[model samples]
Target: MKAAVLREVRTPLQIEDVQINKPGPHEVLIRTAAAGVCHSDLHFIEGSYPHPLPAVLGHESAGVVEQVGSEVRTVKPGDHVITCLSAFCGHCEFCLTGHMSLCVSPETKRGQDDEPRLTSKKGPMMQYLNLSSFAEQMLIHEHACVAIRKDMPLDRAALIGCGVMTGVGAAMHTSNVRPGDTVAVIGCGGVGLAAINGAAIAGAGRIIAIDMAPGKENMVKAFGATDFICAATSADVVKEVIEMTKGGVQHSFEAIGLSKTAEQAFNMLRRGGTANIIGMIPVGQTITLMGAAFLGEKRIQGSLMGSNRFPVDMPRLVDFYMSGKLHLDDMISRRIKLEDVNDAFTEMKTGAVARSVIVFDA
Candidate 1:
């Protein structure tokens, strides 16, 4: 199988013929259908986040089950599924307490003594974030993916695997945006737009979408943003948001993963409001805040994979899409083949599109 391999950081991914192993007990092998080129993958590509080298790069994806391990019962051959990075071990404290996204158990992965799931002509290869959907196929733990309705298109379903899940989950689960609340999302990229849409679905009375590009206002508004602010043109984004809301919003989301924006998200919150950071800020970067802000009970917290419980959330999200409530059709900017993955990353850096999907041959 051909896959995009990242051999080094701050370098282009190399397309190579990699070998995928068969499913072990509790594992599932899926034929790659579509994979989204998300900003999170760019984090690893640019060394903003670190990962083992010579690993496959893509993660946000959906596919069909080609084969299942002996013990796998959640899905079977021909089932359509979406892959998630937050694979959980069911008995972990986090999972037992309804926080499956927090689980980091090694039980979901092969032990050190076990043979690697992938390899190359050169040597052993690493399976990235459990799924590694950049390739023609994936061998992953059954827990890492959940079966979705077959009527749902795999390309759009791919977006739900990560970017959609993170944005929507942040608004609905992490912060619990109630009806009639005000929300300001910092960034209008795939995740940011989804946050706005999620906030609307949660019945937010007003949703403010912020971005550096003025051109994104129209696109952002279509996704349920009641207002749009160009951060680049504004003198002070936080002040502008506060002024527009007459004080401050009840919830603010930082989707750009910048320390400055994270702080702004905190500063733009009303008293006792919550700020959710959905972006993966680069390692070693620090966010500083005012000490006195705590007096008003303003709280800022990090959100992982939108605090998702994929087995339940994903299927419902599919239902939302099928019902025409989730605006997924407009989110896909373009579709390209596997070999064009590099160009997709280039486009992502420019923020020219909401999402670029890698469609695999059937």
Candidate 2:
């Protein structure tokens, strides 16, 4: 199978003929259909997040199940599924407690002594985030993917695997934004736009979209942002948001994962409001908040994978997309082949494309 392999940090992904192993007892082999190039993938490429080298880097994807392990029962060989990184051990404490996203049991992955699921002519290559959909095929734990309706487009379903789920789940589940509430989302990328869309779906009275790009305002507005704020022109984003909302918004979301933007998200919240940080901030960065900010009951919290239970939430997201309530078609900027993964990352760094999907041939 051909895969885009990251040989080094701050380098281009090399397209190589990699070898994928057959499914183990609890595993499934999926024929990659579509994979979304997300900012999270760029983060690893740019060294914002560190990982083992010679890894296949892609997580947001949807595909058809070509084969399943003997123990796999949730999906059959012909099922279409969306892959998720949060592969949980069903018996873990986190899973039992209904926080499957946080499940980190060793049972979810093969033991160190076991043969690697992926390998190359050089040797075994580490799989990125359990599901390396950049390849022509992916061998992953059955729990890492959820079977979805066959009617859903693989390109759009790929978005729900990560960005859509993260953004929409952050608004709907984490912050619990309600009708008549006001929401301010920092960053107008794919995830940010989805956050705005989610807020709209949740019936937020006012949705504010913030970004440094002036070109994104119209598209952001179309995604349910009632107001737009260009952060590049504003010297103080918190003040502008407060003034825009006639005080501050009831809820604020930070999707850019920057220290400044995270702080601004907190500062842009009204008294007794909540701020949810959805971006994957780099390690060793500390965000200092005002000591008195908590006095007014303004809380700042982190959201992981939209606090998702993929099996339940992903299908609903598919339904939402099918119902025309979710705007995924506009979110896709372009579709490229696996060989163009390097250029896709370059476009991601430029902040020009909302999403660049890698469509694989069956």
Candidate 3:
């Protein structure tokens, strides 16, 4: 199958004919339908996150099941499914305790002695995360994906797999923003806009969208933000947010994953408010916080995959989109083919586009 192979760090993904293995007992083979280019994938490309090289890179995707292993029962052949990186081993402590995203069991992946799930002329090709949806076909654990309603567009559904899940889950689950709470989300990208939308869906009294670009105000407001603040124009974002809310918001979310913005998110919170960090900060970068600030009961926490239970949340997200509550239509800035993956990553660096989807030919 034709797939994008990242052979080295800080380089373009090469499109090549790679080999995918047959399904394992708990695996499922999916025919890639649509995959969304996300910032998280860029982290690996830029070397912010380290992964084994010569891997197929992509995670946010939706596809049709081509075949299932003998023991796979969650989905059948021909099912429409959204794949998630947070593959869980159902019997682990985290899974049993309702924190499936935190599961780290080795059972979900093949052992060292086993044959690799993918390979190329050079050698074994590592699977990025668990999905590796940038390829024409993905062989992943059955638990990594869930079947959604067939009518849902796979392109839009692809966003729900990662960006949407992270943003919405951060608002609805992690911080638990209430009906009358105020929320300020840093960064107006795909994840940031989804955070704003999620806050609205959670009935936030006021939602503020912050970004460095003034042009994004209209787009951000359209996604349920009651107000927009251009961070580039502001001398102090934290002060501006505090003044706008008369003291500070009940909740603030950092979606950009910068140390400065993460600190600002904490500083923009009201007393007893919670700050959720949704971005993947680079390895070894320390996020410093004020020592005295803890006296007021202000708390900062991290959210992984929006603290998601993909099996339950993904389907509901699709329903939200179908019912016109989720604004995925505006989220897609462009639709490209697999060969255009490199350009998509370039555009992501500009921070101008919300999302780009790769639609595979049937």
Candidate 4:
């Protein structure tokens, strides 16, 4: 199968033919239909985050099951599915306690001694996440994906895998935004827009979308943000948000994942409000907050995959999309095939598009 292989940091992914293994007892094999070139993938590609080299890099996707291992019962051949990076071990303390997204047990992947799931003539290739959807196929643990209705468009459904789930989950589960609450999202990319849309669905009275991009008013407004704030790097963003909400928003989300903006998200929160950090900050970087700030009961927390339980939440997200309550069509800025994955990352760096999905044939 053809896949985009990331062999080094600060380099373009080479589109090459790769090899895939059949399903393990708990694995499911999928024929990739559509995969979203997500910002998360870009993080790894650009060295913002590190991963093993010579890996197939993609996680947000939806496809049809072609085969299932003997022990895989969650889905069957011919089922439409959305893949998630948060592959759970199902019986870990996290999963047992309703925190499946936090699971990171090695049990989810084959042991190093065992045969690799993917390889090239050079050697064994690491799978970027449990699901490497950038390729024409994905061999993943059954828990890493969930079945959605066949009526849902696979292209749109692909967004739900990571960006949609992360944004919405951050709003509904991580911070638990309440009706009538005022909220501000720090970035207006795919994840940020999803947070705004999720805030709307959660009934937030005021949703503020922040971005520096021109021509973003319509995009943010379409996703249910009542107001748009054009961010200036040098401007006092916290002051702007505080003044707009008359004090501060009830909740502020740092979706951009930078130390500067993470601090701003906390500063823009009202007393007792929570700031959820949804972006993947680079390792070794730390965020600092004033010591006096905590006296006001202002809190900051990190959210993993929007604190998702995909099997339950994902299908409901599909229903939300199907019902027209969730705005997804506008999130897709372009649909390109796998060969054009590199250009999509370039567009992402410019922050000019919401999402670019790899429709196997797109």
Candidate 5:
């Protein structure tokens, strides 16, 4: 199988032939159909986040089950599925308490002594986020993927595996945005747009989209942003949001994962409102908050994978897409082949495209 392998940080991923192992007990082998090039993948590639080298780096994907391990019962050989990074060990303390996204038991991955799932001519290639959908196929734990309807397009379904789920789940699950509420989302990238769409779906009365890119204002409006704020010239974003809402927004989301934006999200929240951080901020960066802000009952929290229970939420997202409520077609800025992954990342770095999907051959 051919895969885009990250040989070094800040370098183009090498497209090379890689070997994928068969499914282990409780594992499933999926033939990759479509994979979304997400910002999280760029973070590790640019050394913003650290991970093992020679890894295949893609997490947001959807595919068809090529094979299943003997113990895998959640999906069959022919089922269509969306892969998630949050592979949970159902017996873990977190999973037992309904917080499956936080499960970190060793059972979810191959033991250190076990043979690696992927290997290149050099040696075993580390799989990124347990899915590594950048390759032609993915061998992952059954818990890492949820089977979805066959009618859903693999390209669009791929978005729900990560960005869509993260954005929508952040609003509906993490912060619990209510109808008639006002929401302000920082950053207008794929995740930010999804947050705005989620806010609309949640019936938020006012949705403000913030971005430095002037062109994105239109896209944001199309995604249900009630108003757009250009961050470039806006000296006081929090103040602008407060004035626009006649006060502060009921909920605020930081999707860019920057310290400044995260602080702004908290500052823009109304009294008793919640600020949800959805971006994967780099490790070791500290964010400072107003000490007196808590006196008003305001809170700031981190959201993991939209606090998702993939099995339940993924299908609902698929239904939402099928019902025409989720506008996925516009979200996909372009589609390219595996060889074009480097260019896609370059485009993403420029903040010129919403999402560039890697469509695999059937």
Candidate 6:
């Protein structure tokens, strides 16, 4: 199988032939249909986040199951599924408590002593996340993926796997945006646009989409943003948001993963409002905030994978798409082949495109 391998930080991913192992008990082998080139992958590729070298790097994807392990019952061969990075051990405390996204139980992966799931001529190749969907195939724990309807296009389904789920989940689950609430999302990328859409679905009365690019206003508005703010042109983004809402919004989301944007998300919140940080801020970066802000009961917190329970959330999200309420058709900027993954990353850095999908041959 051919996969995009990252051998070092701050380097281009090498497209090379890699070997994928068969499914073990509780594992599922999928024929990769489509994978999204997300900023999260760029983070690891640029060393903003660290991962083991010589790894196949991709997490947001959807595909068809070709084979399943003996113990796998959640899905069968020929099922369409969306892969998620938040693989959970079903019996863990987090899973039992309705917080499956928080589960980091080692049961999800093979022990170090066991044979690696992927390998190359050099040696064992590390799986970037539980699901390395950049390759032609993915061998992952059954819990890492949820079977969805066959009617949904795998390319659009791929976006639901990560970016969609994260953005929507952050709005509906993490911060629990209420009807008639005001929301300001800091970033109009795939995740941020989804956040705006999610907030609209949650019935937010005013949805403000913030971005450095002024050209995204029309696109962002189509996704349910009631207003658009050009962060680059504004003298003070936080102040502008506060004035626009007459005293700050009920909820503000930091989707850019920058310390500056994160602080702005906090500052743009109304009293008793919650700020959800959805972006993966690079390691070692600290976000400083005003101590007096706490007196206003403003709370800021991190959101992982949009606090998702994939097994339940993903299927419903699929239904949302099918019903024409999810607005996924406009999200895809373009589609490319596996070999063109590098160019997709190059486009992502510009922040012009919403998502670039890697469509694999059937």
lDDT of 1 by residue, 1-362 (tens): 99999999988899999998889999999999999999999999999988888899899999999999999989999999999999998998999999999999998998889988999999989988988999999999999999998899999999999999999999999999999999999999999989998999999999999999999988988999999999889999999999999989999999999999999999999999899999889999999999999999999999999999999999999999999888898899999999999999998888769999999999
Per-model C-alpha RMSD: 0.7, 0.9, 0.7, 1.2, 0.9, 0.7
Candidate 6 lDDT tens digits, 1-362: 99999999888999999999989999999999999999999999898888988999999999999999999999999999999999999998899999999999999999999999999999999997899899999999999999998999999999999999999999999999999999999999999989998999999999999999999999999999999999889999999999999999989999999999999999999999899999999899999999999999999999999999999999999999999889899999999998899999998999899999999999
Candidate 2 residue spans exceeding 4 A from truth: none
CA shift at 340, candidate 3, in angstroms?
0.8
RMSD of 6: 0.7
Q: After superposition, how far is residue 314 of candidate 1 from its true place, in Å?
A: 0.6
lDDT of each: 0.94, 0.92, 0.94, 0.92, 0.93, 0.95
Q: Candidate 5: where is the Cα deviation over 4 Å?
A: none
lDDT of 4 at 184: 96
TM-scores for all predictions: 0.99, 0.98, 0.99, 0.98, 0.98, 0.99
Question: Which clashing pairs does model 6 show?
Answer: none
**Winner by lDDT between candidate 4 and candidate 1:** 1
Q: Write the per-residue lDDT of candidate 2 for residues 53-163, one digit (tens) a residue.
A: 989999999999999999999899989999999999898789999989889888878889999999999999999998988999999999999999999999999999999
Give the C-alpha miss distance for residue 344 in model 2, angstroms. 0.9
lDDT of 3 at 302: 97
Model 4, span 134-202: residue lDDT tens = 999999999999998999999999999999999999999999999999999999999999999999999
Give me the displacement of residue 328 in model 5, in angstroms. 0.7
lDDT of 6 at 142: 96
In model 4, which runs have C-alpha deviations exceeding 4 angstroms? none
